[model samples]
Target: MMAQWHPIAPGEPLRAGDQGPRIAQLRKLLQMFGDYNGHPGPVTANNNNPERFDAGLQLAVESYQRRHGMAVTGVADKATLKELERPPVDLARQLEVNAKRWDKLPDKPGKRYILVNVPDFRLHLIEQHRVVLSMKTVVGKSSKRTPDMTSKVVSVVFNPTWTVPRSILLTDLLPKARNNPEAMHRRGYRVVKYGTNTTTPISDKSIQSAARGKATLRQISGPGNTLGRVKFIVPNKQAIFLHDTQAQSLFEHHHRAFSHGCIRLQQPEELAYALLGPQGWDRTRVAQATTGDESITIKVANPPKLFIAYFTAWVDGLGKVHFRPDIYHRDN
Candidate 1:
């Protein structure tokens, strides 16, 4: 059955009234994924208008979207295309590969656990087997793939300063800083001596020296901060954690693998409140901590355990099958 399937690579969404070979491609994909029961019907029929997008096909698309954790718009959108464009053989391979991953999971994850499935670009807060909270996440780019690990969100830092990582300095910002030192300062950056917090303000001359690798730079906490207003410190060797992002607009895109190595949350405040509320932190206090220039780090005495998993395919507790694109090509 998989051998008879072909890939569907539409450049745009296919709605209810669309027609052409793309529609047939859509139907065949939906059929291949078990979304449509009229397999041998539409696929095998010799009708002259087999490429028409009828209402039944639209319903099938919605079913596929809903099961795959996507917006059920009844249109073949990019997220849907990312899944359907894959040949059936690859998807089957994902199931077999992910099954081994699923087996490694502990039978009892805990009363509460944070699950960040990298390929799915989503974070779910599970409490007693119920998904009490879920949100969109921007994960590491392909070049710096987010690693799978176990850790605890040990602290929540409010109004955190962005200490520019050394790799990012050389690879991303050094050229731009050399181009315009003043603009770099205007962008909330300060050239400071490496490994020490210099209290005095730095000069433009220092910016050039910093760009030339004489020193390091850090972004002050202010408007448009790189770490946004908050940072969740999940302790692991990789130094990866979940945090708010200044580029909140990135959450609106369907494909959200854009971070360097951390997971950027769409609704970080919600997660923050969830984590700190039990520790007697109210929303008013939380909001206040996030404001102002001073950085505050609150230690979590009982932090929630975090599990970052990489699964291209898995079945949700609700029995809905979910498959994601092999963005890092790990599904061998």
Candidate 2:
């Protein structure tokens, strides 16, 4: 009696050295996804050498990991292998979804603009035809998600005042104030009560007494400020813009989507320089702007168009299809 063998289907995803009529079809698909625009190459069939994977295939896997902010070990571990084995059909579907989203982006080109890709956790400064600077970024959390919209750079605030949002004040600061009232004062926050129906303001002393025993106090600016040292204002209803974060350690992670509802730039000064141009402002000047006596706005001579887009699948400069995890679940 002979053992039975299963027949492989055409157009199915292939592992290394998966030979048959389907091999050609699989190879072509692999080529399409392999190194084209700084993307990784495809895996090769070298079954004889169990100790080492093919050079080209290993390179491709490593490149993919690097781009997605994954651990860059050349060996195809379980996670790497799983990603490598993603079906072509699935990849095509993601590409289509992202393409539709890209279509909705603004076509206008400003003299200088900042483009932030939320899922990719990166910000690109596009001036003329080139990307002036590229850096890692942290976007809004899933709950307080950063909205996808466009706006112009109104002004750059140096040593800006941090106004606490009602949401943060109620959920985060209030709880903390309950724990320790001095803690709020130590952090440069002043509590205030406002009229329920009107925009009537309350005095600092009144707010202090109102929140004496209760933990419903609001904090203002200082080193513990959520907005860090500086904030870049954009005229939008979303009340979103690029700002510095105290949690700098998050930037080291590849996928840094951990903000409340704003975009956090890893290197804000670099972006400022690129946006401000010619009129050079050093770190001291930037620091002054962020922490000066009052908030100041520096208007650009010709502001560049800012586009905050979400693209999970794209063909890199090398023509290879680069697929990233739909971190925001925007594809669905």
Candidate 3:
């Protein structure tokens, strides 16, 4: 005989006092996540069938949503159900991969510091034992390939000048220069000419012809700058740092790894404040430090420890495993 599906048996006018099978299951689920106390008062229509889907259950759902960066509507809708029903094996696999990656990080202590997880596309500002602030971030594209590494932030550059990378100059800008030299200059790129034996300043028209013929050329910075208003200088071999990007629209997306090789922050100023707070440096002082003619290095009184880790799976504080999409395909 096949098992029969039943209506859980409270009747059409089920009240708060009713104890149905559905309500029992809901309570079990909440307990799994350490959220049993969320039920609050008696289950009623005012709180959306509390006996079956009570306030406690809703709060549990909201907690899950917040951790995963989802809308915390407190109702288990289609998306919520899908997330909740994700296979445990998959979550375990992600956690394992990220844990291995975390094992390869450096252990250094400072007063405060910023850490960015490229694959996860998030940033954390850690101060002492607590995570002071967290924000969404955009990383480099697969082609540009942002590398995972660590370094000390030496200084911040405001209204900074950008030195175009050779790869971009050869692949992207040179082609455009061949077509219109003026376009490069109008957009703040300084063009130069290189001969068989020496190099000299060149006209836009000349650059265009040379680019058309596949000659090597480069551009210097101005208005349509890739690095927007400011840049955080971190001394590392990868030449990567936290910089402002003109492409602010990318932040609206859930997955935001779309840079050349640097981590673009959603809230660079707030991060600046957090990092500099222990040093007794305010916004005005930090801004002044970056605006001078030369790059300045302001050593923190006590540097903060940073962990740029990639974890797709992990047990939360409640001991329930949380899973995230492996956007970088690092596990595979």
Tens digits of per-residue lDDT, candidate 2, 1-332, equal 01221222434433444446544332333345553222234434543332333444455556666755467775445665456556656767888998888788757666567788888888888777577799988998888888887777766765565656667776776666657656667776665445322222234454455445432344344567667766788888877888877899998786677888899888887677666655677666765666644656687656666788888877766575566778778898
| Residue 213, model 3, lDDT | 52
Q: How many backbone clashes does candidate 1 have?
A: 0
Name the runs in model 1 displaced over 4 angstroms: 1-14, 18-34, 37-52, 66-73, 76-88, 199-214
lDDT of 3 at 19: 47
lDDT winner, 2 or 3: 2
In order, candidate lDDTs are 0.81, 0.65, 0.63
* Global CA lDDT computed for model 3: 0.63
RMSD in angstroms, candidate 3?
6.4
lDDT per residue for candidate 1 within 1-332, as digits (tens), equals: 66787778547888878888989888877876778655234543443355888767888898898766577899888777877766667667779999999888788888988999998899999888899999999999999889998888889988888877768888887777777767877878876777678723346677566667767778898666899988999877777878889898998887788999899999887888888889898888899888878888898767888999998888877676787777898876
Ranking by lDDT: 1, 2, 3
Best-to-worst order by TM-score is: 1, 2, 3
Best of the two (1, 2) by TM-score: 1
